[model samples]
Target chain A: MQSIGKRAAMLGVFSGGAILLGYVESLIPVLFFVPGMKLGLANLAVVLALYYFGPGDAAVIQLVRISVVGFLFGNLFSIAFSLAGGFFSLAVMCLAKRYGRFTVYGVSTAGGVSHNIAQICVAAVLVENVKIVYYLPVLLLSGLATGLLIGLAGDETMRRLGAPPKFYDAVSNQ
Target chain B: MKHRERRLNRWDMALVILVLAAALAGFLLELTWTGQGASLQITVDGEVFGTYQLDKDQTIDIGGGNRCRIEDGAAWMEWADCPDQLCVRHTHISRANETVVCLPNRVTLTVLGGEDGEVDTIVS
Candidate 1:
Protein backbone atom coordinates (compact mmCIF):
# COMPACT_ATOMS: atom_id res chain seq x y z
CA MET A 1 0.00 0.00 0.00
CA GLN A 2 1.21 3.48 -0.78
CA SER A 3 1.75 5.95 2.05
CA ILE A 4 -0.59 8.91 2.37
CA GLY A 5 1.97 11.19 0.72
CA LYS A 6 2.14 8.78 -2.19
CA ARG A 7 -1.64 8.54 -2.06
CA ALA A 8 -1.77 12.30 -2.24
CA ALA A 9 0.44 12.03 -5.29
CA MET A 10 -2.06 9.48 -6.51
CA LEU A 11 -4.58 12.28 -6.54
CA GLY A 12 -2.86 13.50 -9.65
CA VAL A 13 -2.62 9.95 -10.90
CA PHE A 14 -6.29 9.25 -10.20
CA SER A 15 -7.15 12.51 -11.86
CA GLY A 16 -5.36 11.41 -14.98
CA GLY A 17 -7.20 8.11 -14.72
CA ALA A 18 -10.44 10.01 -14.29
CA ILE A 19 -9.80 12.22 -17.29
CA LEU A 20 -9.22 9.12 -19.35
CA LEU A 21 -12.37 7.56 -17.95
CA GLY A 22 -14.39 10.67 -18.74
CA TYR A 23 -13.31 10.72 -22.37
CA VAL A 24 -13.88 7.00 -22.73
CA GLU A 25 -17.33 7.19 -21.19
CA SER A 26 -18.21 10.01 -23.58
CA LEU A 27 -17.02 8.07 -26.57
CA ILE A 28 -19.35 5.12 -25.88
CA PRO A 29 -22.08 7.40 -27.32
CA VAL A 30 -25.22 5.59 -26.08
CA LEU A 31 -26.50 7.16 -22.86
CA PHE A 32 -28.63 5.46 -20.21
CA PHE A 33 -29.76 8.73 -18.67
CA VAL A 34 -29.96 12.22 -20.11
CA PRO A 35 -27.31 12.76 -22.76
CA GLY A 36 -25.43 15.23 -20.58
CA MET A 37 -24.74 13.08 -17.50
CA LYS A 38 -21.76 10.73 -16.87
CA LEU A 39 -20.19 8.49 -14.24
CA GLY A 40 -17.59 11.12 -13.17
CA LEU A 41 -14.68 8.85 -12.22
CA ALA A 42 -12.60 11.94 -11.40
CA ASN A 43 -14.35 11.77 -8.06
CA LEU A 44 -11.90 9.05 -7.05
CA ALA A 45 -9.68 11.84 -5.75
CA VAL A 46 -12.47 13.10 -3.55
CA VAL A 47 -13.01 9.60 -2.20
CA LEU A 48 -9.30 9.30 -1.48
CA ALA A 49 -9.25 12.65 0.29
CA LEU A 50 -12.03 11.82 2.77
CA TYR A 51 -10.42 8.51 3.65
CA TYR A 52 -6.79 9.61 3.90
CA PHE A 53 -6.61 13.32 4.74
CA GLY A 54 -10.03 14.15 6.30
CA PRO A 55 -13.24 15.64 4.93
CA GLY A 56 -11.99 19.23 4.79
CA ASP A 57 -9.09 18.26 2.57
CA ALA A 58 -11.37 16.13 0.50
CA ALA A 59 -13.67 19.06 -0.12
CA VAL A 60 -10.80 21.32 -1.13
CA ILE A 61 -9.39 18.73 -3.50
CA GLN A 62 -12.77 18.28 -5.12
CA LEU A 63 -13.22 22.00 -5.59
CA VAL A 64 -9.85 22.38 -7.22
CA ARG A 65 -10.45 19.48 -9.58
CA ILE A 66 -13.91 20.77 -10.52
CA SER A 67 -12.56 24.22 -11.31
CA VAL A 68 -9.64 22.91 -13.34
CA VAL A 69 -11.77 20.44 -15.27
CA GLY A 70 -14.39 23.09 -15.99
CA PHE A 71 -11.86 25.52 -17.38
CA LEU A 72 -10.04 22.88 -19.36
CA PHE A 73 -12.86 20.97 -21.03
CA GLY A 74 -16.19 22.51 -20.09
CA ASN A 75 -18.33 25.53 -20.92
CA LEU A 76 -19.94 28.02 -18.55
CA PHE A 77 -23.15 25.97 -18.36
CA SER A 78 -21.21 22.83 -17.45
CA ILE A 79 -19.22 24.70 -14.82
CA ALA A 80 -22.41 25.63 -12.99
CA PHE A 81 -23.52 22.04 -12.97
CA SER A 82 -20.14 20.84 -11.69
CA LEU A 83 -20.19 23.37 -8.85
CA ALA A 84 -23.52 22.11 -7.58
CA GLY A 85 -22.63 18.42 -7.77
CA GLY A 86 -19.02 18.60 -6.56
CA PHE A 87 -19.78 20.89 -3.63
CA PHE A 88 -22.87 19.02 -2.54
CA SER A 89 -21.18 15.63 -2.64
CA LEU A 90 -18.18 16.87 -0.70
CA ALA A 91 -20.39 18.41 1.96
CA VAL A 92 -22.35 15.19 2.35
CA MET A 93 -19.22 13.11 2.68
CA CYS A 94 -17.84 15.51 5.27
CA LEU A 95 -20.97 15.20 7.35
CA ALA A 96 -21.03 11.45 6.98
CA LYS A 97 -17.44 11.26 8.17
CA ARG A 98 -18.46 12.81 11.49
CA TYR A 99 -21.24 10.30 12.25
CA GLY A 100 -19.87 7.18 10.62
CA ARG A 101 -16.63 5.42 11.47
CA PHE A 102 -13.71 6.32 9.23
CA THR A 103 -14.74 4.07 6.42
CA VAL A 104 -13.54 5.47 3.14
CA TYR A 105 -16.07 3.50 1.10
CA GLY A 106 -19.11 4.75 2.97
CA VAL A 107 -17.93 8.34 2.77
CA SER A 108 -17.36 8.05 -0.93
CA THR A 109 -20.83 6.52 -1.40
CA ALA A 110 -22.49 9.40 0.37
CA GLY A 111 -20.57 11.84 -1.78
CA GLY A 112 -21.60 10.14 -5.00
CA VAL A 113 -25.30 10.17 -4.18
CA SER A 114 -25.25 13.81 -3.08
CA HIS A 115 -23.36 14.86 -6.18
CA ASN A 116 -26.05 13.61 -8.59
CA ILE A 117 -28.92 15.10 -6.59
CA ALA A 118 -27.34 18.55 -6.58
CA GLN A 119 -26.73 18.46 -10.31
CA ILE A 120 -30.33 17.47 -10.99
CA CYS A 121 -31.57 20.26 -8.76
CA VAL A 122 -29.38 22.74 -10.64
CA ALA A 123 -30.86 21.62 -13.92
CA ALA A 124 -34.39 22.01 -12.62
CA VAL A 125 -33.58 25.50 -11.38
CA LEU A 126 -31.93 26.47 -14.66
CA VAL A 127 -34.94 25.41 -16.75
CA GLU A 128 -37.16 27.45 -14.42
CA ASN A 129 -39.49 24.46 -14.14
CA VAL A 130 -39.77 21.64 -11.70
CA LYS A 131 -41.19 19.51 -14.45
CA ILE A 132 -37.65 18.34 -14.87
CA VAL A 133 -37.97 16.85 -11.41
CA TYR A 134 -39.23 13.74 -13.06
CA TYR A 135 -35.60 12.95 -13.55
CA LEU A 136 -35.10 12.81 -9.77
CA PRO A 137 -36.25 9.28 -9.09
CA VAL A 138 -33.88 7.96 -11.72
CA LEU A 139 -31.03 10.13 -10.50
CA LEU A 140 -31.51 8.83 -6.98
CA LEU A 141 -31.46 5.28 -8.24
CA SER A 142 -28.22 5.81 -10.13
CA GLY A 143 -26.70 7.66 -7.17
CA LEU A 144 -27.37 4.82 -4.76
CA ALA A 145 -25.75 2.24 -6.98
CA THR A 146 -22.75 4.32 -8.00
CA GLY A 147 -22.22 5.51 -4.45
CA LEU A 148 -22.02 1.96 -3.16
CA LEU A 149 -19.48 0.92 -5.75
CA ILE A 150 -17.32 3.98 -5.18
CA GLY A 151 -17.47 3.54 -1.42
CA LEU A 152 -16.63 -0.16 -1.64
CA ALA A 153 -13.61 0.58 -3.80
CA GLY A 154 -12.23 3.05 -1.28
CA ASP A 155 -12.80 0.68 1.60
CA GLU A 156 -11.10 -2.23 -0.12
CA THR A 157 -8.17 -0.07 -1.12
CA MET A 158 -7.49 0.82 2.52
CA ARG A 159 -7.93 -2.75 3.77
CA ARG A 160 -5.52 -4.12 1.20
CA LEU A 161 -2.83 -1.67 2.30
CA GLY A 162 -3.17 -3.04 5.89
CA ALA A 163 -3.86 0.48 7.02
CA PRO A 164 -6.62 2.20 8.91
CA PRO A 165 -6.85 5.77 10.20
CA LYS A 166 -3.10 5.41 10.64
CA PHE A 167 -2.69 5.33 6.87
CA TYR A 168 -3.62 8.97 6.83
CA ASP A 169 -0.49 9.63 8.88
CA ALA A 170 1.59 9.40 5.74
CA VAL A 171 0.09 12.66 4.52
CA SER A 172 -0.52 14.14 7.98
CA ASN A 173 1.34 17.45 8.24
CA GLN A 174 2.01 16.78 11.89
CA MET B 1 -7.69 -1.84 -5.05
CA LYS B 2 -10.48 -0.48 -7.25
CA HIS B 3 -10.91 -3.74 -9.14
CA ARG B 4 -11.57 -5.95 -6.13
CA GLU B 5 -14.78 -5.23 -4.23
CA ARG B 6 -17.35 -7.30 -6.11
CA ARG B 7 -19.65 -7.91 -3.17
CA LEU B 8 -22.47 -5.41 -2.58
CA ASN B 9 -25.17 -5.22 0.05
CA ARG B 10 -28.82 -5.80 -0.80
CA TRP B 11 -29.48 -2.07 -0.51
CA ASP B 12 -26.95 -1.51 -3.25
CA MET B 13 -28.74 -3.82 -5.63
CA ALA B 14 -32.10 -2.19 -4.93
CA LEU B 15 -30.67 1.25 -5.50
CA VAL B 16 -29.33 0.38 -8.94
CA ILE B 17 -32.57 -1.21 -10.02
CA LEU B 18 -34.62 1.72 -8.77
CA VAL B 19 -32.49 4.26 -10.60
CA LEU B 20 -32.71 2.38 -13.87
CA ALA B 21 -36.48 2.33 -13.61
CA ALA B 22 -36.68 6.04 -12.88
CA ALA B 23 -34.48 6.86 -15.86
CA LEU B 24 -36.86 4.99 -18.10
CA ALA B 25 -39.82 6.89 -16.69
CA GLY B 26 -38.14 10.27 -17.24
CA PHE B 27 -37.37 9.39 -20.86
CA LEU B 28 -41.04 8.57 -21.46
CA LEU B 29 -42.13 11.89 -19.92
CA GLU B 30 -39.74 13.75 -22.23
CA LEU B 31 -41.23 12.00 -25.23
CA THR B 32 -44.77 13.13 -24.39
CA TRP B 33 -44.09 16.62 -23.05
CA THR B 34 -43.46 18.16 -26.45
CA GLY B 35 -46.02 20.91 -25.89
CA GLN B 36 -44.84 24.42 -26.79
CA GLY B 37 -46.19 27.94 -26.19
CA ALA B 38 -45.88 29.33 -29.72
CA SER B 39 -45.51 28.33 -33.38
CA LEU B 40 -44.09 29.59 -36.62
CA GLN B 41 -44.24 33.36 -37.14
CA ILE B 42 -43.21 33.91 -40.73
CA THR B 43 -42.22 37.33 -42.04
CA VAL B 44 -41.39 38.56 -45.52
CA ASP B 45 -39.96 41.94 -46.63
CA GLY B 46 -41.10 44.01 -43.63
CA GLU B 47 -44.72 43.00 -44.23
CA VAL B 48 -47.16 41.34 -41.79
CA PHE B 49 -47.20 37.96 -43.50
CA GLY B 50 -48.74 35.00 -41.52
CA THR B 51 -48.64 32.62 -38.56
CA TYR B 52 -48.45 28.80 -38.21
CA GLN B 53 -49.75 26.54 -35.45
CA LEU B 54 -47.60 23.44 -34.97
CA ASP B 55 -49.00 19.85 -35.09
CA LYS B 56 -51.79 21.17 -37.35
CA ASP B 57 -52.19 22.27 -40.99
CA GLN B 58 -52.75 25.75 -42.51
CA THR B 59 -51.55 28.12 -45.27
CA ILE B 60 -49.76 31.47 -45.73
CA ASP B 61 -49.37 34.04 -48.53
CA ILE B 62 -45.77 35.27 -48.71
CA GLY B 63 -46.16 38.86 -49.96
CA GLY B 64 -48.16 37.65 -53.01
CA GLY B 65 -45.10 35.98 -54.54
CA ASN B 66 -45.23 32.59 -52.83
CA ARG B 67 -48.28 30.67 -51.54
CA CYS B 68 -47.69 27.64 -49.33
CA ARG B 69 -49.97 25.36 -47.34
CA ILE B 70 -48.99 25.24 -43.68
CA GLU B 71 -48.60 21.54 -42.98
CA ASP B 72 -47.37 20.25 -39.61
CA GLY B 73 -46.45 23.69 -38.26
CA ALA B 74 -44.30 24.66 -41.28
CA ALA B 75 -44.82 26.75 -44.41
CA TRP B 76 -43.75 24.95 -47.56
CA MET B 77 -43.84 27.02 -50.70
CA GLU B 78 -46.68 25.24 -52.55
CA TRP B 79 -46.21 27.77 -55.36
CA ALA B 80 -43.39 30.29 -55.60
CA ASP B 81 -42.11 32.76 -58.17
CA CYS B 82 -38.70 32.53 -56.50
CA PRO B 83 -36.03 30.29 -58.00
CA ASP B 84 -34.65 27.13 -56.33
CA GLN B 85 -38.06 26.48 -54.63
CA LEU B 86 -36.29 26.49 -51.28
CA CYS B 87 -39.12 28.14 -49.34
CA VAL B 88 -41.38 25.19 -50.11
CA ARG B 89 -38.77 22.89 -48.62
CA HIS B 90 -38.98 24.55 -45.19
CA THR B 91 -39.42 21.91 -42.49
CA HIS B 92 -41.56 22.21 -39.37
CA ILE B 93 -39.88 23.64 -36.29
CA SER B 94 -40.68 21.35 -33.37
CA ARG B 95 -37.97 22.68 -31.12
CA ALA B 96 -38.17 25.90 -29.16
CA ASN B 97 -36.13 28.97 -30.10
CA GLU B 98 -35.23 27.55 -33.49
CA THR B 99 -35.47 29.54 -36.71
CA VAL B 100 -35.59 28.44 -40.35
CA VAL B 101 -34.43 31.38 -42.44
CA CYS B 102 -35.18 31.68 -46.12
CA LEU B 103 -32.71 34.20 -47.46
CA PRO B 104 -33.76 34.17 -51.09
CA ASN B 105 -37.18 35.77 -50.43
CA ARG B 106 -36.10 37.40 -47.18
CA VAL B 107 -38.62 35.33 -45.25
CA THR B 108 -37.88 33.78 -41.85
CA LEU B 109 -39.70 31.22 -39.68
CA THR B 110 -39.21 31.29 -35.93
CA VAL B 111 -40.56 28.81 -33.36
CA LEU B 112 -41.03 29.96 -29.80
CA GLY B 113 -41.89 27.29 -27.28
CA GLY B 114 -42.76 27.34 -23.58
CA GLU B 115 -43.60 30.57 -21.74
CA ASP B 116 -40.65 32.55 -22.99
CA GLY B 117 -42.86 35.62 -23.38
CA GLU B 118 -44.20 35.52 -19.82
CA VAL B 119 -40.94 34.48 -18.23
CA ASP B 120 -38.26 37.10 -17.85
CA THR B 121 -35.04 36.41 -19.74
CA ILE B 122 -32.18 35.23 -17.57
CA VAL B 123 -29.40 34.12 -19.87
CA SER B 124 -29.20 32.42 -23.25
Candidate 2:
Protein backbone atom coordinates (compact mmCIF):
# COMPACT_ATOMS: atom_id res chain seq x y z
CA MET A 1 0.00 0.00 0.00
CA GLN A 2 1.10 3.52 -0.65
CA SER A 3 1.89 5.91 2.17
CA ILE A 4 -0.93 8.16 3.34
CA GLY A 5 0.74 11.24 1.84
CA LYS A 6 1.26 9.54 -1.49
CA ARG A 7 -2.36 8.39 -1.56
CA ALA A 8 -3.57 11.88 -0.78
CA ALA A 9 -1.38 13.39 -3.48
CA MET A 10 -2.63 10.91 -6.05
CA LEU A 11 -6.22 11.51 -5.07
CA GLY A 12 -5.75 15.24 -5.41
CA VAL A 13 -4.24 14.87 -8.85
CA PHE A 14 -7.07 12.62 -9.97
CA SER A 15 -9.68 15.00 -8.61
CA GLY A 16 -8.07 17.96 -10.37
CA GLY A 17 -7.85 16.05 -13.61
CA ALA A 18 -11.49 15.05 -13.34
CA ILE A 19 -12.56 18.65 -12.85
CA LEU A 20 -10.47 19.90 -15.74
CA LEU A 21 -11.80 17.30 -18.10
CA GLY A 22 -15.31 18.06 -16.94
CA TYR A 23 -14.79 21.68 -17.89
CA VAL A 24 -13.44 20.67 -21.25
CA GLU A 25 -16.42 18.40 -21.76
CA SER A 26 -18.85 21.18 -20.94
CA LEU A 27 -17.34 23.23 -23.71
CA ILE A 28 -18.08 20.68 -26.37
CA PRO A 29 -21.56 20.81 -27.92
CA VAL A 30 -23.07 17.37 -28.25
CA LEU A 31 -24.27 16.11 -31.61
CA PHE A 32 -27.60 15.15 -30.06
CA PHE A 33 -28.10 18.75 -28.94
CA VAL A 34 -29.28 17.78 -25.50
CA PRO A 35 -28.37 19.32 -22.18
CA GLY A 36 -26.28 17.16 -19.78
CA MET A 37 -25.04 14.99 -22.64
CA LYS A 38 -21.35 14.99 -23.39
CA LEU A 39 -18.33 12.83 -24.04
CA GLY A 40 -18.12 12.19 -20.30
CA LEU A 41 -14.49 13.18 -20.38
CA ALA A 42 -14.39 13.36 -16.58
CA ASN A 43 -14.91 9.64 -16.36
CA LEU A 44 -11.47 9.27 -17.88
CA ALA A 45 -10.06 10.25 -14.53
CA VAL A 46 -12.40 7.89 -12.74
CA VAL A 47 -11.32 5.05 -15.02
CA LEU A 48 -7.71 5.77 -14.32
CA ALA A 49 -8.27 5.74 -10.56
CA LEU A 50 -10.23 2.52 -10.77
CA TYR A 51 -7.49 0.76 -12.64
CA TYR A 52 -4.51 2.24 -10.80
CA PHE A 53 -5.72 2.73 -7.22
CA GLY A 54 -8.42 0.08 -6.77
CA PRO A 55 -12.18 0.48 -6.46
CA GLY A 56 -12.19 2.00 -2.98
CA ASP A 57 -10.02 4.88 -4.05
CA ALA A 58 -11.88 5.05 -7.33
CA ALA A 59 -15.18 5.29 -5.44
CA VAL A 60 -13.82 8.08 -3.28
CA ILE A 61 -12.60 9.91 -6.35
CA GLN A 62 -16.02 9.60 -7.96
CA LEU A 63 -17.87 11.14 -5.01
CA VAL A 64 -15.42 13.95 -4.37
CA ARG A 65 -15.24 14.85 -8.02
CA ILE A 66 -19.03 14.98 -8.45
CA SER A 67 -19.65 16.98 -5.30
CA VAL A 68 -16.90 19.47 -6.02
CA VAL A 69 -17.74 19.80 -9.68
CA GLY A 70 -21.48 19.91 -9.14
CA PHE A 71 -21.18 22.52 -6.43
CA LEU A 72 -18.93 24.67 -8.57
CA PHE A 73 -20.22 24.19 -12.11
CA GLY A 74 -23.70 22.64 -11.89
CA ASN A 75 -26.95 22.91 -9.94
CA LEU A 76 -28.67 20.62 -7.48
CA PHE A 77 -30.72 18.78 -10.09
CA SER A 78 -27.68 18.14 -12.23
CA ILE A 79 -25.86 16.90 -9.18
CA ALA A 80 -28.63 14.48 -8.33
CA PHE A 81 -28.69 13.00 -11.83
CA SER A 82 -24.91 12.88 -11.98
CA LEU A 83 -24.64 11.17 -8.62
CA ALA A 84 -27.18 8.55 -9.62
CA GLY A 85 -25.37 7.92 -12.90
CA GLY A 86 -21.90 7.95 -11.36
CA PHE A 87 -22.80 5.55 -8.57
CA PHE A 88 -24.33 2.93 -10.84
CA SER A 89 -21.60 3.29 -13.45
CA LEU A 90 -18.88 2.90 -10.84
CA ALA A 91 -20.53 -0.16 -9.38
CA VAL A 92 -20.78 -1.89 -12.75
CA MET A 93 -17.23 -1.04 -13.74
CA CYS A 94 -15.85 -2.22 -10.41
CA LEU A 95 -17.71 -5.48 -10.63
CA ALA A 96 -16.56 -6.09 -14.18
CA LYS A 97 -12.97 -5.20 -13.37
CA ARG A 98 -12.97 -7.39 -10.29
CA TYR A 99 -14.42 -10.34 -12.19
CA GLY A 100 -11.41 -10.22 -14.56
CA ARG A 101 -13.54 -11.37 -17.50
CA PHE A 102 -13.73 -8.17 -19.50
CA THR A 103 -10.85 -5.89 -20.43
CA VAL A 104 -10.59 -2.23 -19.53
CA TYR A 105 -12.58 -1.17 -22.58
CA GLY A 106 -15.38 -3.56 -21.70
CA VAL A 107 -15.53 -2.31 -18.15
CA SER A 108 -15.56 1.28 -19.28
CA THR A 109 -18.32 0.61 -21.80
CA ALA A 110 -20.42 -1.02 -19.13
CA GLY A 111 -19.84 2.02 -16.98
CA GLY A 112 -20.97 4.25 -19.81
CA VAL A 113 -24.23 2.44 -20.60
CA SER A 114 -25.15 2.08 -16.96
CA HIS A 115 -24.40 5.73 -16.42
CA ASN A 116 -26.89 6.90 -19.08
CA ILE A 117 -29.55 4.38 -18.10
CA ALA A 118 -29.35 5.42 -14.49
CA GLN A 119 -29.47 9.10 -15.36
CA ILE A 120 -32.56 8.70 -17.51
CA CYS A 121 -34.19 6.66 -14.78
CA VAL A 122 -33.60 9.46 -12.34
CA ALA A 123 -34.95 12.02 -14.80
CA ALA A 124 -38.10 9.99 -15.27
CA VAL A 125 -38.61 9.80 -11.55
CA LEU A 126 -37.97 13.48 -10.99
CA VAL A 127 -40.24 14.71 -13.78
CA GLU A 128 -42.91 12.15 -12.92
CA ASN A 129 -43.13 11.52 -16.60
CA VAL A 130 -42.45 8.17 -18.17
CA LYS A 131 -42.16 9.86 -21.55
CA ILE A 132 -38.68 10.78 -20.43
CA VAL A 133 -37.81 7.17 -21.05
CA TYR A 134 -38.19 7.92 -24.73
CA TYR A 135 -34.80 9.53 -24.54
CA LEU A 136 -33.20 6.22 -23.53
CA PRO A 137 -32.33 5.10 -27.06
CA VAL A 138 -30.33 8.23 -27.76
CA LEU A 139 -28.69 8.07 -24.37
CA LEU A 140 -27.75 4.43 -24.84
CA LEU A 141 -26.10 5.08 -28.18
CA SER A 142 -24.16 8.07 -26.94
CA GLY A 143 -23.15 6.25 -23.79
CA LEU A 144 -21.72 3.39 -25.83
CA ALA A 145 -19.77 5.73 -28.05
CA THR A 146 -18.39 7.80 -25.18
CA GLY A 147 -17.68 4.74 -23.08
CA LEU A 148 -15.61 3.18 -25.84
CA LEU A 149 -13.64 6.36 -26.31
CA ILE A 150 -12.99 6.82 -22.58
CA GLY A 151 -12.06 3.16 -22.15
CA LEU A 152 -9.50 3.30 -24.91
CA ALA A 153 -8.03 6.47 -23.47
CA GLY A 154 -7.93 4.92 -20.01
CA ASP A 155 -6.22 1.76 -21.30
CA GLU A 156 -3.42 3.79 -22.80
CA THR A 157 -3.16 5.98 -19.70
CA MET A 158 -2.96 2.95 -17.41
CA ARG A 159 -0.33 1.39 -19.61
CA ARG A 160 1.74 4.57 -19.65
CA LEU A 161 1.37 5.42 -15.95
CA GLY A 162 2.31 1.87 -14.93
CA ALA A 163 1.89 0.96 -11.28
CA PRO A 164 2.74 3.33 -8.48
CA PRO A 165 5.56 2.60 -6.08
CA LYS A 166 4.30 0.59 -3.06
CA PHE A 167 1.04 0.06 -4.93
CA TYR A 168 -1.51 -2.34 -3.47
CA ASP A 169 -1.57 -4.54 -6.56
CA ALA A 170 -3.12 -7.54 -4.84
CA VAL A 171 -6.04 -5.53 -3.53
CA SER A 172 -6.74 -3.88 -6.88
CA ASN A 173 -6.29 -7.12 -8.74
CA GLN A 174 -9.69 -8.12 -7.39
CA MET B 1 0.25 -6.53 -13.56
CA LYS B 2 -1.35 -9.58 -15.07
CA HIS B 3 -4.63 -7.75 -15.52
CA ARG B 4 -2.82 -4.81 -17.01
CA GLU B 5 -1.08 -7.10 -19.45
CA ARG B 6 -4.48 -8.35 -20.61
CA ARG B 7 -5.55 -5.80 -23.21
CA LEU B 8 -8.44 -6.07 -25.61
CA ASN B 9 -9.44 -9.72 -26.03
CA ARG B 10 -12.31 -11.84 -27.32
CA TRP B 11 -14.28 -11.01 -24.22
CA ASP B 12 -13.88 -7.35 -24.97
CA MET B 13 -15.25 -7.88 -28.47
CA ALA B 14 -18.18 -9.78 -27.01
CA LEU B 15 -18.91 -6.95 -24.65
CA VAL B 16 -18.79 -4.43 -27.46
CA ILE B 17 -21.17 -6.54 -29.48
CA LEU B 18 -23.52 -6.80 -26.55
CA VAL B 19 -23.49 -3.05 -26.08
CA LEU B 20 -24.12 -2.41 -29.73
CA ALA B 21 -26.97 -4.87 -29.69
CA ALA B 22 -28.54 -3.09 -26.76
CA ALA B 23 -28.16 0.25 -28.47
CA LEU B 24 -29.71 -1.08 -31.65
CA ALA B 25 -32.59 -2.52 -29.67
CA GLY B 26 -33.29 0.82 -27.99
CA PHE B 27 -33.09 2.67 -31.28
CA LEU B 28 -35.50 0.32 -32.99
CA LEU B 29 -37.91 0.39 -30.10
CA GLU B 30 -37.98 4.17 -30.14
CA LEU B 31 -38.42 4.33 -33.88
CA THR B 32 -41.27 1.87 -34.01
CA TRP B 33 -43.30 2.85 -30.99
CA THR B 34 -45.94 5.47 -31.71
CA GLY B 35 -47.70 7.65 -29.17
CA GLN B 36 -51.44 7.00 -29.08
CA GLY B 37 -52.81 9.51 -26.60
CA ALA B 38 -56.46 10.48 -27.00
CA SER B 39 -56.34 13.60 -24.85
CA LEU B 40 -53.79 16.12 -23.66
CA GLN B 41 -53.16 16.00 -19.93
CA ILE B 42 -51.75 19.21 -18.55
CA THR B 43 -49.66 19.09 -15.42
CA VAL B 44 -48.43 22.13 -13.54
CA ASP B 45 -45.80 21.66 -10.89
CA GLY B 46 -46.57 17.95 -10.95
CA GLU B 47 -50.25 18.48 -10.39
CA VAL B 48 -52.98 17.32 -12.75
CA PHE B 49 -54.60 20.61 -13.67
CA GLY B 50 -56.73 19.50 -16.61
CA THR B 51 -57.23 17.09 -19.49
CA TYR B 52 -58.42 18.10 -22.96
CA GLN B 53 -59.60 16.07 -25.90
CA LEU B 54 -57.31 16.07 -28.89
CA ASP B 55 -60.24 15.95 -31.28
CA LYS B 56 -61.47 19.32 -30.03
CA ASP B 57 -59.52 22.47 -30.79
CA GLN B 58 -59.25 24.85 -27.84
CA THR B 59 -56.89 27.32 -26.19
CA ILE B 60 -55.96 26.80 -22.53
CA ASP B 61 -54.69 29.21 -19.91
CA ILE B 62 -52.75 26.73 -17.73
CA GLY B 63 -52.36 27.77 -14.10
CA GLY B 64 -49.09 29.51 -13.23
CA GLY B 65 -49.11 31.77 -16.28
CA ASN B 66 -48.75 29.41 -19.25
CA ARG B 67 -50.95 29.35 -22.35
CA CYS B 68 -51.28 26.57 -24.93
CA ARG B 69 -53.37 26.10 -28.01
CA ILE B 70 -54.76 22.82 -29.27
CA GLU B 71 -55.57 22.90 -32.97
CA ASP B 72 -55.69 20.58 -35.95
CA GLY B 73 -55.41 17.59 -33.63
CA ALA B 74 -52.24 18.89 -31.93
CA ALA B 75 -51.34 20.88 -28.83
CA TRP B 76 -48.54 23.43 -28.60
CA MET B 77 -47.31 26.12 -26.27
CA GLU B 78 -48.70 29.43 -27.54
CA TRP B 79 -47.15 31.42 -24.74
CA ALA B 80 -45.07 30.82 -21.62
CA ASP B 81 -43.37 32.99 -19.01
CA CYS B 82 -40.33 30.75 -18.87
CA PRO B 83 -36.97 32.17 -19.91
CA ASP B 84 -36.23 29.64 -22.59
CA GLN B 85 -38.80 29.32 -25.36
CA LEU B 86 -38.15 25.60 -25.74
CA CYS B 87 -41.72 24.64 -25.06
CA VAL B 88 -43.00 27.24 -27.48
CA ARG B 89 -40.59 26.04 -30.15
CA HIS B 90 -41.60 22.45 -29.66
CA THR B 91 -43.71 21.11 -32.53
CA HIS B 92 -47.36 20.41 -31.99
CA ILE B 93 -47.88 17.03 -30.37
CA SER B 94 -50.89 14.80 -30.94
CA ARG B 95 -49.54 11.37 -30.29
CA ALA B 96 -50.39 9.43 -27.19
CA ASN B 97 -47.87 9.72 -24.35
CA GLU B 98 -45.96 12.51 -26.03
CA THR B 99 -45.01 15.54 -23.97
CA VAL B 100 -43.94 19.15 -24.25
CA VAL B 101 -42.31 20.18 -21.02
CA CYS B 102 -41.29 23.57 -19.67
CA LEU B 103 -38.72 22.88 -17.04
CA PRO B 104 -38.55 26.41 -15.69
CA ASN B 105 -42.30 26.72 -15.40
CA ARG B 106 -42.70 23.14 -14.19
CA VAL B 107 -45.44 22.63 -16.75
CA THR B 108 -45.87 19.40 -18.69
CA LEU B 109 -48.39 18.69 -21.41
CA THR B 110 -48.69 14.96 -21.90
CA VAL B 111 -50.85 13.06 -24.29
CA LEU B 112 -53.42 10.93 -22.52
CA GLY B 113 -56.01 8.28 -23.52
CA GLY B 114 -53.99 5.62 -25.37
CA GLU B 115 -53.16 2.16 -24.10
CA ASP B 116 -49.89 3.33 -22.63
CA GLY B 117 -51.50 6.51 -21.31
CA GLU B 118 -54.15 4.46 -19.56
CA VAL B 119 -51.49 2.37 -17.90
CA ASP B 120 -49.50 5.49 -16.97
CA THR B 121 -52.59 7.17 -15.53
CA ILE B 122 -53.26 4.14 -13.38
CA VAL B 123 -49.64 3.98 -12.25
CA SER B 124 -49.42 7.70 -11.53
Task: Tell me the TM-score of each prediction against the true structure.
Answer: 0.55, 0.77
Q: TM-score (0 to 1) for chain A, all models?
A: 0.78, 0.89
DockQ of each: 0.10, 0.35
Model 1 misplaced regions, further than 4 Å? A1-30, A33-36, A101-105, A169-174, B1-124
Tens digits of per-residue lDDT for model 1, A131-167: 4454465566567667767776666677775464675
Give the range of the ten consecutive residues with the poorest summed lDDT in model 1 chain A. A29-38
DockQ for candidate 2, C-alpha atoms: 0.35
Error of 2 at B1 (Å): 28
Q: Report the poorest 10 consecutive residues by lDDT, candidate 1 chain B.
A: B115-124
lDDT (Cα, 0-100) at B113 in candidate 2? 49
**lDDT scores for all predictions?**
0.59, 0.77
Please give, as one word, the docking class of candidate 2.
acceptable
- On residues B27-92, what C-alpha lDDT tens digit does candidate 2 reach at each position? 677556765557888877677878787777888898747898988888999999865466787768
lDDT of 1 at A163: 66
Worst 10 residues of 2 chain A by lDDT: A165-174
Residue-by-residue lDDT tens digits, candidate 1, B1-124: 5785555455445544655666678666655654563565555653435555655676666677766565655444566665434445544445654444343455655555656554332111
lDDT for A61 (candidate 1): 69
